[model samples]
Target: MREDLRYLLSTFTARDRFLLVMVVLAQFTSALLDLVGIAVVFPLMQALTGASLEGGILGRLYDVLGGGSRERFTIVLALIMILAFLAKAVLASIILWWSSGIVVRLQTTTSRRLLQHYLTEPYLRHRDRNVGEVISAVGQGAQMAHTSVLGGLLQVLSQAMSIGLIAVFLLVVAPLPTLAAIAYFAIVVFGLQRALAPANRKAGLEAQNAAWASSHALVDSLHGFRELTMHDAQGFFVDRFDVANVSQAQSARRANFLAMLPKSVLELTTMAAIALLVILSVATGSEAAALPTLSLFVAASIRILPSMVALTATLGTIKVGRAGLEVVVRALQEALTSGVDDQDPRTTAALPVTEAPIEVQQVGFRYPGAGRDVLRDVTLRIPNGSSLALAGPSGSGKTTLVNIILGLIPPTSGSVTYGDVPVRQSDQWWHDVVAYVPQDVYVADDTLAGNIAFGVPEDQRDDELVRRSADRALLGDLLAELPDGLETRVGERGSRLSGGQRQRVGIARALYRQPQVLVLDEATSALDNETEHRMTETIRSLHGEITTIIVAHRLSTVRHARQLAFLADGRVEAVGTFNEVVSASPRFARLVALGQLDLQEGPESA
Candidate 1:
């Protein structure tokens, strides 16, 4: 628990820590006011009952208030008590409001930080982890930290302080009863902790895992909804989701039940302690004289009992949430130590707006935990403002090589350089000069102009530039058909647009950046022959204006390239012009023959 608290505190900023201290002070002040309110009850009761107030702090207060008649003294005491109670209530409300704000801020800050960490991580790191688990950590884990960790700790602190102060006052008035009550409460709490610790931990871990699994099930089902519907396999995903949902519900039920148990047990114990105190007063034959002290103790008990119950319940919640807290903390720690410096280079230096040839020399790569290299001593050079096509089998390291060129991942051996500078040394600059269009482009549910202008902020989006890029990608005709033109809203993942239109939107987005080099990784693979040819023509139009690298299985897509490279078994088999490579390598010749036949047959026949 101490370790968990330390980690929780580390999550807070200095300003937040300061606010927390203020909250504690406010709570302590409220508790003191409450104690004063309870202490005054004894004097007020004595005065009303016609008992003498000639001793103790109450007596001193009575003298200060000019005690003369019982009626007058009672009235003054009553007013004092009323005012104190009102003041305490007001302060308590303020404390509640302030703490609520802190919890909200904590949730937002943690979520944002976790998201930033995830975004800044390298591509390989993201591919290695489960997306659902990451989503849960960013969503549910942040909420738990606010509700279970920070909120629980604050509740425990405030209640414990109030309980402690009230107990001390009770001890001053009636030490024996107060000590007995403390001992009983301590025993109940300790025993409950010992008995429920294991179950609480188990529930917490199960809840976290189940939640992640449910999220994974939902995301998978939604992403593959088309396939499931076509194959009538929706029941399989439904059953998987149901199992996870049931487990999560069970864990939540168990946790809530355990949290409520403390209140029930404490209530019973409180009743017994009050009864015992009455019995002790009677047995001592001081029952008649102990009325004032009994009244004070009762008033203190009213506040202290609830404080004890709340403290116990909050402790239980913390126990159940510890597992989630650990997971969130671990993710934050990993992100902090990921060793990726993601600061904007524009802060220090600006990249030159010029084209440069990309050169790869003896580059090799092996995926983490893989037995063999994916790329072995692979080397190539792309000239400035010249098109190069990379044609290879599915597992021949084409995408991997592109990723290295894009500076998304580092090579295991040797290096990739641009204009005599290593890519790693100018990663940010490299990104600025290169634009990539994958086979399937991601389109947000936003306006056509927004999707075309992708990363540019709304206020900064240039309509002229968007139109120019759209025209360059051959999207002018589609835009003309739309009712709202640039303002048309593209459905989620561009569902509103045809596959060809979506690919064109992606090309327009890449062109919007006006990059010095454009990379297309089988970007036209899913289109029909007409769309494929049109997209290829669009690429050909860029010719000498942009350095283009094409990774394609379709021979027609790369036929116009000045140079072509063929890869096999993680090594470059041949690198030359189309006819040169086809003549030099039988493998290249065979692939071209197959590609041409597929294109001639049309996609339906292929």
Candidate 2:
């Protein structure tokens, strides 16, 4: 716990430290009012019994209240008590409201910073971490810290203040018994912490495990819902979820039981002490002494025991909070250590005016945990105003190469250049010029215009431009059919649209950027032959206007490219016009034999 505190303290920025101080001071002020309430209890009691204090603190309190009839005095005292209660209530309310808002804001800020870091950080960092876990940890960490750390600290302070007041009053009354009671309470709290520490740790781990398991189940279910429904496997998923829920419940129950044990023991010990005090007061010498002693013992015990109970509960919360703090601290550490000094050089103000030729020079890359390179010593030059096609079997590094070109992955060796400048170092230049249509089209749960303008700035999104891009990508007819036209909401992932329509929407999205270079990675795989043919014609029509790179599985699409390259394993096997590569490379000849290439052999081949 001490180590956790030290670590948490280290994460606080200067501004956070200031907020911490303000929260602490507010809590202390509230606690002081509670202590004052306890102090007033003794004077009220003495006044009720017709006992007058000649010169002590109670005497001063009596003089301050002023002489009056019993009814008038009661009224005055009630008003003062009411005012004090109101003041404390106001303070508590403000503290609680502000704390809750601050926690929410802080969590939002943390999550936003995390997202920015995720986008700007190196690709390898994402591969090393879990996205779902990072988000969950940030959310839960802020909630727990606010509730347990800040709230528990306030509770403990309130309890400590009450104990302090009781101790001071005890000095004027039964000192020995008061000391003994305090000692007993402290011992019980310490015992509770010792016993529950392991339980808190175990419970925290179980909670995190259950969260991950549930999230994994949800992701799997969504991805494979169709298959599951066809197989009638609802019971299987339900059973899996039940296992996680039950494990979480059992762990919580155990932790609660452990936390309660010491408080119960402390309460039993308190009752024994109260009983002994009562007996001693009743048996002792004079009635005056006996009455006051009993009153002091009862008042002090009542005040102090409640505080002890609160502290015991607070101790458990603080322990659990310590566990949550670890997750938050780990996430912050990761974000700070990402070393993204050269990640992206793009700025919104400086947009690329035209596309430049893209060149991959002796680049090589391998996935983490994989033994061999997915792309190796690969070199290619796609000049501006030309269309090129990459043809390959599955696992021939087609997607891997595209990822490198898009700046999604960095090469392990060599570099990619646009014109003469390194692509990574010229992010803004490349971003405005290059657009990608990925194999898996992502249609957001938003309007048609929104999905097309996913990366476009709001101030730049024009309705006319959106319509123009739609027409260019052949999605204008589809949009015209929608009830709201461009304003119509697309269902999640465009599940309402046919596969070809979704693909066209994706193409329109890329075209919306008005990019100088457009890369399509099997973008037409979802469309039928006629749709594919139309889309290919639309792409070919762009011709000298933009540089185009297409990864195609269909022979018909590959034949349209001015140049074609066949990739085998992790290297280029052949590159030339259709006949040049077909005659020179046997690998190309086999591809033709396997019907992987469309040859212009007959008059009907058109």
Candidate 3:
């Protein structure tokens, strides 16, 4: 728990810490004002009742205020009390403003840091985790930090301060009674905490787990809504989500009930204690002399009892939120130790413009915790300004090989290089020279020009470059069809565009970077015949100008490539021109015979 608290505090900046200190000071000041206000009540009451004020600070103040008649003294004391409370109100507002501001900043800052960390981590890390869980951790986890850690801490501190200062004032006014009251409240708080600790902790843990589960289920249901509706399986998701939501609500209810329980018990105890004090004062025959002091003690208790109750409530809330704090702390620690470089100087640097060949030398790759290599001894060369088509059946490691060549992942053995330089050492320069279009193109809900000029800053976006790239990607006709040309809005994930149009947007995005190497991982497989032909023509035009690597299951897409490589069982079966591969490898010939390559015409015709 101590370690978790330390980590939570570490997330705050120096400025935040300073603001926290100011809030604490403001709380203390408010407590002091409350004590002063309660103290004034005694003098005002004494003046109203015509009691002697012959000693103490009130007597001295009475003398200073002309030692006036009781009515005038009462008015003066009442005005002072009002002013003190008014000042306290202002201080209370300041405390609230600062504390709320801190909580908001923590939520936003932690969420941003988590997102940036996720983005900077290696690609494999992303693949190995559940996307729904990641989303939950970043989105809901941040809200938990705000409600559980920062807000809880501030509440506990301010309430505790108020209770402490008020108790001290009571002790000064009536030591014996104050001590007795303190001891009784202490025993009650301790006993209640002991009784409720296990239940609170259990409820908190349950709530945290249920929250994550519900969030994950909801995201999954939304992302797969089309599939669910088509298959009549929406009830499955709804049932799953219903169970999680009910559990979360139950746990929250249990925790909140426990947190509020202390207020009721404290209120009863306070009324009984006040009644007992009054009876004892009257029974001892000291009622006349003790009335002023008794009133003072009773007034202090009236203020202090509520503070004690609030303190207890805040403590209960903290216990209920402990599990959430632990989860957030663990996430932060993992991000810090994940071995991903958060700051890479090369991200903003200029890339080399000279073209170079990419070479793969006996590269083998086994996925983490996998039993066998996905790619073994895969050696290939993509010469500068030449197109290569990587052909393979499913699970034959074509995509893995392309990933290695693109430097997205390191090989388990051997090396991949660009000319004489290792790809990893080039850092962002490698990415700057290469653009990748995946099978599923991601289109943002943005303007057509914005999607095409994706990563470029809005102020730096060049309309001319967008037009040129769109033309090269064969999107000119699509743009003409749009009512707003480049300014047309693509719906979320490009729902506004056809599959072929989305693919063209992906192509235009890659071309806008003016990459030396363009990689298409089954980019044309989703398009219709005519659209695929157009896309293939676009690739053909770049054949001699930019190095192109195409991983294709459709044979027609790669039929015109300068070189072809066939892979099977994690090994390269053959590498040559298409005709040479077909003549040399029986497996390649079999695939062609079985029509697995989806040829428009016979192999001999190609």
* lDDT values for all models: 0.84, 0.72, 0.83
Candidate 3 Cα lDDT to native: 0.83
Per-residue lDDT of model 1, residues 1-606, tens digit only: 667567767868899999999999999999898888888888776776667678877688789999787778888888888899899999999898889899888888778778777776788987787888888899887777678878888889999888888888878877887787788889988998888888888988888889899999999998898899999989999999999999999999999998888888888887887788789889999887888888887787787878888888888888888877887888777867875333543343466435778889999999999999999998899998888999888899999999998888899997988887787623577777889999888999999999999977899999999999999888888988999999999898888898878888889999999988999998888778987888887887787899999999888888778788998889999988777778788988898787663323221232
Best candidate (score: TM-score): 1
Worst 10 contiguous positions by lDDT, candidate 2: 340-349
Superposed on all Cα atoms, model 2 deviates from the true structure by an RMSD in Å of: 3.5
Estimate, for each residue in 161-201, the C-alpha lDDT of model 3 and write its tens digit. Answer: 77787778778877898899899889988988888888888
- Which candidate comes out best when scored by lDDT? 1
Quote each prediction's TM-score.
0.94, 0.89, 0.93
Question: Which residue pairs in candidate 3 collide?
Answer: none
Candidate 2 C-alpha error for residue 508, in Å:
1.0
Candidate 2's C-alpha runs over 4 A off are 1-13, 65-79, 127-132, 149-174, 255-272, 285-287, 290-297, 300-304, 340-354, 425-429, 455-460, 596-598, 601-606
Could you tell me the TM-score of candidate 2?
0.89
Model 3 residue runs over 4 Å out of place are 64-66, 339-347, 596-606
Task: Provide backbone clash counts, one per model.
Answer: 0, 0, 0
**Candidate 2's error at 465, in angstroms?**
2.0
Cα lDDT tens digits for candidate 2, 138-254: 556555554666556656776676577658767656577667766776677787788778777777667666665666566667767789899999789878867877886786686
